[model samples]
Target: MIEESEKGWLLDNGLVAYALRVGEDGVLEHLHFGGSLGSLAGFSAWPRQAYRSLQIDDRGKPFRHLGTLAQELPFFGRGDFRSPAIAAPGLDELVFESARKIEGGLDLGDLPSARFEGAETLQIRTVSRHMGLEVVLSLTLWPGHPVLARTVTVRNISDRPHLLDRASSLSIDLPQADRHIVHLTGSWAREMHLQRHRIETGRFSFGSCRGTSSAQHPPFIALTDTDTTELHGEVLGGALVYSGNHETVVEKDEFGAVRLQMGLPGGMRWPLAPGEAFIAPQALLLHTDRGLGGMSHGWHDFVRERLLPERREPYRPVYLNTWESAYFEVDEDKVEKLARAAKKLGCEMLVLDDGWFKGRRDDHTSLGDWQADPKRFSRGMGELARRVTAEGLKFGLWFEPEMVSRESDLYREHPDWIIGADRDRPGEGRNQLTLDLSRPEVEAHIESVVASMLREADISYVKWDMNRFVSDLDDAKRAHLYMLALYRIVRKLRKAFPGVVFENCASGGNRFDFGMLCLFDQTWTSDLCDPEGRLDIQSGASHFFPLSALASYIGPSPNHQNGRISSFEARRDVAFFCGSRGFSLSAEELEAHASSVKETAGLYTSTQSLVTKGRFDRLRTGAEIIWQLTSPSGDEVVILYARKRSEPNPPFASVRLRNLEKGSAYRMEGSGELWRAESLMVAGLPMPHTDHRANPPLMKALPTGDMATALLRLRRV
Candidate 1:
């Protein structure tokens, strides 16, 4: 570790900077910076690998391709700037230069380095000084692990009081190329673009969506389905530019590095007064591999691995979801219809969704009443469970157990059961209040619901939905406590229903982070199910999650969230990325596309062991196309590829089966007959590239199209 002087001369670029001692192990472990007083570069040492250059300004223009890079930079601070060329000291120096004086003042005098009692934190400090604000970037490594994290703390230490922006900037890499930036915030991004390496930059446009925070706060950007390669190593730097008013651009470096840039309100615009500081909570993890492969391996080995990872056992079977059909209103008949459809389609379980309780309709009311809705099912809820069992399908039920509807019996009796400031003023969202699971009574209520459903209905699956975010930030206790409550609930539920599967949903994908994967068997990837959208959705989700515990449930085309239609085969191909699969479409709608849907379903089911249980090898996704290959039994292999746009000549994607014993005989169904490993061992096997435009061809015998029922039978030597 090294420390440097606070006072320093400005470089030619109008940036005052200092160097830190670089690590030899390839992990950039520590950083030492100063504001010209003295050399603080020796404060500490850091892993070189921990930091990367996030150059957001591809063309050095003030606003071109701004939002695309904004999504990557995590923490950004706002301060006064009149043609200010303020430079951040991360990612090879991604600078927010030449910006008009925004409306905030910053001070760095009282800024100090933070240290934890334990060395396990791998904590290091990053200091950046501008005219009015001093920004400190601290990274805490996960004890002894290679993964480093980012935490930004800004203080108002200036004598004259000034305001600051709420958001901070973070820069990482994006390996995917040529994908649209879909900002989750409500405010539209002005200009966005992508510039790869020394290559020229292109104009970038963002998808429309609402911001996750108030206008003054930095909005969260959700960049859905993007190829991993483009956002990988080289794409690791960018900036967050903001006006005190609207618009935030996550400018990326010219070299395609990942970065995040956000706007902050003036000090008066904040919820706090001057002299007080604000901190942005964010993190980053760098695994050896990229996308799903990297995430799956990293998560399993480092974090929790038992959350329904890929299993070859028959216990891991195809399932069906009843949510898309019933929504909130469900009963015996609706449940039965879904169960029968699932059974007919070789599904092992049927998950009954919301509105199965009394006084529940749409998303407005009812959740505490775990009891079945007698009105919807004349024969009663028990009868529905029995009917599902009789139809040879295990039964499951949906519950937003962590929430209470405003009109429900739970909230009606104990108004304090929800998280809020006052019983008179309940924090309402989605017409509901987030359950104060911290309360013993609330925990018991959830436990009883799970127990009763299992005992009464013989249910074997549960799809838990936390549709809304936790509001009433005034009660700061819930941030940490709420998460603990979630963990406890999942722990208890797993203990009681040992064999039951729980699918995690945070209004679909918001909660899809490392913390929750420890509990749920699978996570709903996204609310958008359009096949095209899902391609990037899956890719983005896999950026930090395992493909095994990920669910790619095929929601109907012209999806409920996004009204877009995709072919059944395209949907199937998208779903195959991870193992656990199901359908979220109506039986009626599925019936309309019956033949193609059935064919796609059969293709997934037949080769599922290979798809789910196999070792994954990502083939391509670095350019205009994406593809991956997996081997189930270690003998047989399957490859799937999709081209974003039609190419002059569709290139043949090659695959190498892992863990295959030499001298084994493998059979390619479409290729006919069988071939020995010795033959391919000497000369590698070539995978065919066939047009799967119509329906997938069923290659039963061999030597033709890989087909719908494409079987690649193999035998050990």
Candidate 2:
């Protein structure tokens, strides 16, 4: 799929074509990055206009400078004033040297990368014309998707060490295309709320400088046409394959050209020795003209097909966790009871969350000590796991492996093991300190402790939680190294226990990016399990992730996080939208709402596939929020409809469904009425006549309340 074209290089994956050629100045220039052209048309960069411009080439040739031009890897100096993708001291002028077809893909030593199948990899080598620095630009065109995964490795080939300053994963120029930036921004429990603005003359940037990929600004950005929507415009989606500090910048130069770059944060002074290389984390760029829905579908298919590590066991689980229910008070007897209750509730997994470790009466004491609480579980955790598994449920345990409590013995012995220990000690979060996994000893200790727990107990699943952020935001290299270390530990554990379903939760959904998505089986959508809050969080996350990766759960009536009383029915309705659904209600709460709880479990067991793996779309959002999920074969459709307030004699409302086959007839599950797919999508089906009756009153009464919810299921006849 990679061939030498008339112009330069054509890297095509039978679906999308990414063409690049050497400019007149010997630097690589981006030609076209859209649909295939049947055959190469010798497309090249447009003519440059240096009218009233200041930048110039080496020979003082005006209008021939790199500025106002589209470049492959924008250099630091010599012309382009915009931010460069790769930059370092004494390494400014890097010209295109040579390019060769790489075998499979370059192994990014410690950084996480996606597995490529039917991928055409081309390594374009660019070196400084003056300094002896080499930047190997590796680009992989993933099969069957308009996705390009790029990683830049800078090697110091010079005799002396060089200071590496800025290195981004991928950067591309958009020539004269109208682009509007769309991003997700929020805080801890309120994560992934959508935001957007049109790209103006100035630069617009969004990123996470907080050590962990902050929910406030996770590493994802979309450049769309001015009128882009869910199903209707060209969208260029960029998501970083990194869980640490990252940034995305969209710049509009005076020439009407746009440059978008995504990668690690700037201001890094890491040392690059004579022969040493710095491998950046991979970044993905997916292009689709079919709109945001198309972009999401492409990413979803890629993540499922290539990003997630292959597993042996089926993990479509309806689980119950002990967090909101028991918190730090769960004992062996309590866990066994929950396991039995989970089995009776038709749950497949029972996760004993965060209370089994020794000296862990509260969050202040036992995080590093991974031993079972002898006083709570006299027979040990292994026996308890057996007891849970005996009840036809997979046993899952919680572990904050990257954290240690000062009150624990592990920290008492090795207080210097925590991050920022030698320097200024980082302030504690949740009464715990984050272990410096960048150290070999700390990494080994964590790997040993986590693996031991998995082996000690029949842990079919693990709730890996990081409840804090990194201390130093200034050290980009340190954050990068910590991420690399974390990925190493996770990769090893994944290989050792291929069947265990690992779920990543950084105080719930903070680490919910593609990197963690690929590393773990599922991600907690949010710690806020309230009905409306879950809807918003899940909807925003659904913009980038498949429903299968977002773990949606239902808690008690008076939601623990928000203290907003919601019905069990309303909570279950929202949770059913995700692939991984769970319940975190205490025994008293469960007993109070037995019928609705039982109904949810039975329905979830029978129709999980329709909800979990279906194609998802956010139909509408304002007052009434609607979600649509259609089966792959176009036979079944599941729609979740919820409105917060009960309207007073409101106008007739209906939802137009999406993703159904044309000319097909779908039979409503409960109503037994058949409706054509086209008419349903276009004209829409009228919702329940809630709060008011039709002109002629109907016989049945719809569920009317403040937090009203309804589920509609249909199958092709």
What local distance difference test score does each model get? 0.48, 0.82
- 1-717: candidate 2 lDDT, tens digit per residue: 787864787778766778777876678878777766544664545445555545665447655777777888887667678988987876668788888897678888877778865677999898885789998899898668888888899998889889888889789998887788889999888999988888898788878776888889999888899998888988888999989888898999886788999988777898888999999889998888888888888888888777776765435678888988899998977888888877887788998898888978888998899999899988988999999999999888898999999989899999989877876667888888888877889999999999998888888889899998877446666678888889989989988998788888998878888888778888887889888888888888887888878787788867777789887778888888777788998977767766777788888887777665678888888778988888888888888878888877767678898878899999877778789999999999667657544622321234677888888788998
lDDT of 2: 0.82
TM-score of each: 0.59, 0.97
lDDT (10s digit) by residue, model 1, range 1-717:
112234211111111122323222111211322122134434332221222234243245433223232222232322111111123222122222111111112221221111222212212223232333444444333333323334455545444444443434233334324433433221111111122222224323221111112211222333323444522321121112111122234333444533333332212133224466555433333333233344334433333222232223523356777777667756666677777777776677777777778878877777676666668876766788888889997877778887788777877888777777365575567787787766777777887877777777777777787766666643333343444555677767777777777777656664554335545667666666666666656654443344665676777766676676555666676776765777777879767866766666676677665654555444445332244444644556555555444344456544444435566777765535566766644554444344445223433211222112122345443
- What candidate 1 gets wrong by more than 4 Å, as runs, is 1-297, 300-315, 421-427, 590-602, 622-624, 645-667, 673-717
Minimum summed lDDT over a 10-residue window in model 2 is located at: 693-702
Query: TM-score of model 2 relative to the true fold?
Result: 0.97
Clashes of 1: 115
